[model samples]
Target: MSWPRKPLFGSIRARLLLLLLGGLGTLMLALFLLLDFSIDRQIFGRLDATLLGRARGVVVLLESHPRDDAWQELHELVPEYATGGHTDFVQIWDAAGSTLLSSASNAGNNLQRPPAPVPANAPLFYDLRLPDGHRGRAVGLRFAMPGRADEAVLVVAEEREQVDQLERRVHVALVMGVVGMGLLAALLSVLAVRGGLRPLLAFAAGTGPDGAPRVEPLPVARMPSELRPFADALNAAFARLQAALGRERRFARDVAHELRTPLAETRMAVELATRGAPSAQVLAGALASIDRMQRCIDGLLALSRYEAGIEQAQVEPLELVDLLRRSLALAATPAGKREVTLAASLPDECWVMSDPALLERIVDNLLLNAAEYAPADSTVQLALITSDEGCTLRLGNAAPQLAPDDVERLGERFWRKSAAREASQHGGLGLALAGTLAGLLGLRLHFALEHGVLWAELGPLRPIALPESPAS
Candidate 1:
């Protein structure tokens, strides 16, 4: 059976807080455990030492006096062992396992014996239940008596209730301290996380009413070092978005401006037909205006399709020379009307890989644009230049009116040299569409005006070798 997945924390701030608090809590718990263990060890160590010292004192007394006077001296030297209220106890046993002396605190009961084979010089410390029924710690020692060859075992024990109580108090204090530090750490973590994310929050606040990003750039300098790269990326994205929005606005304005004249012309022509003007003339005007509008709309749609990746190029090997001739043939009528000559420099078969339809549109637009703009009786030159790398199609014409700087604006939509719109039937979208289609075909269109001639160069289009015939 599959188990349901747990939902993760959504907010970065919450995640960071949880991580910091969890790590700090674990560290504090470990520190508390370490300190508690060390403190407990130290407390018991001192208790064991005290018991050993008392046991050693009893042994010293036994060694100093003769057998007859040893017990009396031990009673005098260590009076606590004789008192009923005392917690300290001592027991001595002979080599033959006979008890010689015990503390009065034992109430005739003996302390538990140490394990067998106790060390001779070093004391052995252990824990046991005392005769008085209290938890206690003890030390065992073996020593030789004065004027005697036999060794005796001496055990010293004390009730550890007070030490355990102190340890409990220390444990409580440590718990309280750790809890306080954990709370403080959680607070600091929250503050640190919030402070670190302040820049991102500020960026969110800068968004527009429609939830679009504002034009103002994000403040990268004030952000943390780790977030600076993120901030820079966001800034760059916002800059591009702003540029795109600006372009869209300009495109809308230009489209409206371009269509307004034709629309007015169409409306006027319709009015004249209603008022009984010549039917042929009125219908001709209306049809011409409609045609211009259709062309503009079609160009806009084609450009939009290519830009949006809705139209993909289907590349194949095609003859560039034949394509150029077809484009020139199509532009012949317009060029002749403009009194411009169409000239071509061609090779027999220049094969290049490109989408045939898109390449045809590019050539047609370039030829039409040149024919419309070239001065009367000027020659529009179309050449196919081939090299080891690939082929470049160069189209040039006399552009005495166009300045060097004007070359860059040639591909912009609806851009024209003259302010008078009545002079030209073309909407100036031809070059823009051509450039866009060339890019979609993975071809580069470069414009350069040198010595009063405007040149539009397309390629280095990758050439494809001819397919061999069946006989070959």
Candidate 2:
């Protein structure tokens, strides 16, 4: 058979892992972004609090002096009092708005501001491009200096250069961490998929209908709990398909084998009639051969269909004792002529859901086989019994000892135990057909030999249940 075209997305394991990783990565990225925003807000808020506190402290320091000396004290406090590093710049302004004191030694290069005087009592924090063309954050504090007639101001500013540097470092670390984690996750996903799907891959590699290597189904012990059901289902389907395919192949081979005897007999009969003059004895022998051929053909056809599983039987409640009595009576006349005793020991009114015709056929086949195989004076015993669980039908006969392995091979079409009788009798398909019918009726058919007696048992209907009571 042609194979399904190879999928565009190959290796179910890889595709499954990639899909999981993609989703996991997206979720991790979202979490990282949220965390980054929270960190930025907290850092900025803390920095602003520190700046405001320091600006207020400068206002207190200046309260002690009316002159420029007080501003000098503020400058001296910068190295000890400022919260940040060298990037912090502090400067104080006089009433006339001339620069009084600066933390930087180069006070002449003090940062230039807009011509607008510090808007009265309106402390402002804003971004500016310094004379050096670098971005800076300026915090202007408007307050009255100590003992001064007019309120003065102190501006404490820090550069974007320091904050930008810190942010860049954090960004690099975050990117590295995410990329590393993503790569690790991908690797882990591949490993997980490979390990998880090993059973499926093994199953695929070893399974097919013909000339395929046998793969023992993966047991539940080998599977993860989540995957146990999938494993079990696949195993069941594989077993059924394999069995059905085996049955089809066997059916074809058995059909050809079984047809050979009848065709040969018919051909021999035709040859005999054409080759010789019409004597009464010769014509009689030819007619007998023709009759045997026709009987064999009919038997072969019936056995062929049953073994091929081409026929479906209707099942309903059938009385076991009645069915057994009917089969025994039908086989009794021929069995008596052969000097074989046919008897049935059955329950009075036991019932089962099975195809009545098929069950009768099964009984007939067994009785016929017993009559043929049993010693001339021996008895063929058939019995049907019922209990709380279900019913069983058994047939037993005294016969030549059968090897343990031969018991299993007995149901094969045309397989005979007696080499002397092989040429004269039909063997394999008869028992095989009986077994097939037993299976279709949802019964277990078994064969055993004990103390030189051959016995067969059929049991356990599929829809077995206690009989329902009449409505109250």
Candidate 3:
């Protein structure tokens, strides 16, 4: 699928920063919420304990004697007992359920008793609404005075909206802190992410000017652990690119060298034909030069396409023996000129599935290469080995010039024999292209000298599918 060449607001750097900071913001907000709840619970617990203590103090004061002046000291000591401007409010009821005593702080409000009979000395804490339209907490108890058997119910209550409001303010501040931190973290994260990717940016500069090697490679030593693999891969690719550039320049130079003679001859002939001096011969020479150039160009293109694709477009089952015979026939006149004889052993027919043009090219290159480099008056052998598994085409040529070490470089592009023993017009793309063709055709191409005879073999060919049996 194709995407827009450039999309707005869709960048890896921006997306990464967003994801990183968003996750952190969510985590921070959750922690802050938990913290708010924890703090609120702690504050409310402490406040409830304080209110309960004040309620107990009031209970203690009400049980004491008033004539001993202790009540005055009690009023001085206890906040709820003193009553004015205090948050704590108290109410007491006699045995008949009459409102007996109430704190000035109550403002005529009281905690209601439970409808059932009260349990003695038991205290219950509950939430209630105050007369002033605020929420309150109340502690109620049913108890008798120090000497009386009849029951009295006492209550202490306080407005809680203020503490609740304060807690809300704290929660708001915490939430604001989360928001502020989120923004700060996002900004910092963008900067940090950019800084973290700096080395990668430096590692990835534009490719050097076309058809040239890079001046320098990326610094692998300084790359962080996270990006080391990426750096290594880029370096590897750069190395391959550099090698390809070198090979391309060499190939071009070889092509120019091969074409110079033909192109010069063609130019001279065209000039002669223009002068009307035996135009037909000059024209024929020019046509031959053009055909030579066309062949070289075609070979280069075929090699390139083969390297770039695993399979050629038009593939079919090729008859290996017939292709081999045709290639040998084409090589015979050249071999006869060199006084080199051709020998062959093959089946009546051998079949392998491959692109026929590519197959023909490989066979043609192999036979011609053998004929070109083989010793004059020597015999070049051709043979094909076949089985139910696969087929291998072999070409054996007499190559007295090739050493053990020289054999290894035979298929390298633009490579030639160390000393030019004969005048041959061809560039050294034949064997290299043969190798590429073998790869594209799913065959093996290699050379070895057994008793000073160079062998160029291509196969085992692509596997032929076996026929399926009918259902039993």
The local distance difference test score of each candidate is: 0.85, 0.71, 0.75
Order the candidate numbers by TM-score, best to worst. Answer: 1, 3, 2
* Cα deviation of 300, candidate 2, in Å: 5.6
lDDT by residue (tens digit), candidate 2, 192-240: 8888788777655545546553467756676568767876887777676
Q: What is the TM-score of each candidate against the true structure?
A: 0.81, 0.68, 0.69
Alpha carbon lDDT at 13, candidate 2: 67
lDDT of 1 by residue, 1-472 (tens): 2333223366788788888998999999999999999999999988987887788777777777776577767667677777765388888888888887877767798789987667987888888888868888889898986765788888998898998899999999999999999999999998999988887776566545477876777677776687678778878887877766765676678679878988999999999889875699888988898889888888887877777667999999898899999999999999999899999999888888999999999999999999989999999999999898799999999999999889989898888887874535786789999999998988899999989999999998999888778984
List the candidates ranked by lDDT, beginning with the highest: 1, 3, 2
Better of 1 and 2 by lDDT: 1
Candidate with best TM-score? 1
- Itemize residue pairs with steric clashes in candidate 2: 62-146, 63-146, 413-428, 413-429, 414-428
Candidate scoring better on lDDT of 2 and 3: 3
